[model samples]
Target: MSTRHAVRDDLDSRPWTGPTRRYDILKEGAIALAIVAVLTFGLSALFSSPDEPALTFKGWSQSAPDNMYATMVAEMSGSSETAGYGPPYNVNSDGLSIGPLALQKWFGVTHPIDAAQDFVIAPLQSQQQPDAVTAAVSQWTSASADQRTAWATAYEDALNDPAGANGDATKVPAGDYGPVPTLAAAVVAMASSGAYDGALASAGGHFFNTDNTKQTMLMGDGSYMDDLATAGNLQGNTWGMVNETGSWPGQQWLATYSFWYQLPMFNNEDPNNTVATVLTDNADAIIFAIMFVVILLFVFLPFIPGLRSIPRWIPIQRLVWRQYYREYGKR
Candidate 1:
């Protein structure tokens, strides 16, 4: 060989036969598409989409009228979760915090909710009830705030510990509960008959009150929805946000966002037994603040000092590019 050709030249060192063959690109594309479509159809037929039916007030009221009534009574007395919940709902809201931050209070009241008046009284007043219910409503609306609370408190006690009638508004004793018992029980009956749901749906925003914010809260304040969710292993601590309804895969990507709920501080039990209302409400605000931090971190990851250097430090790039090195690396 000549001295010039004998030199180790990268361009000259590689070998090529210049061989060629006709490839049916269109045919292969069609075959691939058909295979994917068939696999998709078969899988869909074998296992349909996982869709749990929505829990509605109508269903809840019909299933557990007593429980629903009890929940409403608690709400009326300002003892329910919704009543005490912070801004955008009502004042004197509690436990909305993350370290020194009070996000709920800071966010202020955007969508206020008067649990008793909004959930029960408003719905009852929306429809034409019996003469007795009408009388009770009259007294209730005209009564002073203290008088209203007194009546509601008495009814709540009676419902909890019945003297003559059963709790859950089935029947009531001839106690000083007055029109409170009558009104509350009538509300329960209205709910059970599925009238209350429609009333609630139309209560807040006039003819087009399609938003279910208040309705969902009414159920959430009670144990029914939480209990049902718990049964389905959908509690925050259960990693339920990422888990499926059945033993199947779900939105596992949400694990990062839902992880805070599983934390010890956020997962504490309601020692007061008021239930998930207060805790979940507060946890939601706090988790949102933390999630904001997480999102900021993610968005700025590439710009962050040490964080952006992770790929360079780890050097998995070598492994990723190993095949290219073996095929086309310099001698």
Candidate 2:
């Protein structure tokens, strides 16, 4: 063997005989865990927001009845965003796709949702209503699909009109709307009285309901929750995705993920246009794809060509073991 190789092999075989101290690993670990727990509890109690009341459909409807009524109309008409969303809901349109890969469709409609039936019709059917409301529900259910669509369209247009109801179903002008106006009014009343919330909660057919999917979907169909989100600075542009509802620290580590959204390249030029980037309407998918690659790069950093040399170049280990080096050099 060469002199250098012989020396290296000798060094490798050498055992440590330096000054040492007894270490009780278990005791050290227990002490560390106690300190960490105390610090965690202290910091969390000091910084975390108090538990706030959960936002409910009843609270939403009561606070913004006009918006709620408009949302109800949209749900009934099957024109809401959720209604048009395909795959897991219904195949109204192919949902946000990643290039040619229709991941949403491939998964299939695991959680089938019909906006009109689930949000409006079913809830109304389950509720106790007046004679007129009952007649309206019967008329709506018995009508042909085309007739129902026409009635919903006409009523929606009237609601949109500034001179008409303008979101207030009670003030909508008379038209060939069938029993839509009556049904809309009944929904508004039910929502106002908090019965609609109960009806949606029990949609899963359980005495003690836990499924909140229907309730959440119904809320998403409205601008009420959106308004609240905006007010709380929880909008995506505001990095709300990583934020808490009140004055509390959020997922700081997720700041990297949220950074991609702030870029102009990913931002939509027009609010009317759903296509945010060249990825079309799938900005979320594109962002996720980018993040996935970023994560992979991080995971395989040591295997990457130039990246693998970074540790050698920076030599942070020198600083970490400076005391050991000092003691060795003294010898």
Candidate 2 structure quality by residue, lDDT tens digits, 64-164 = 87887777777778788888888787888887767887777888887789887888788889967899999988998899989988998889999888876
- What lDDT score belongs to each candidate, Candidate 1 first? 0.78, 0.80
Best by lDDT: 2
Q: Worst ten-residue run, lDDT, model 2?
A: 272-281
Q: Estimate each model's TM-score.
A: 0.78, 0.86
User: What is the lDDT, from 0 to 100, of the residue 304 in candidate 2?
Assistant: 91
184-246: candidate 1 lDDT, tens digit per residue: 678778877878878887785488766787887888988789989899888888898998887
Clash pairs, candidate 1, are 88-109, 88-111, 89-113
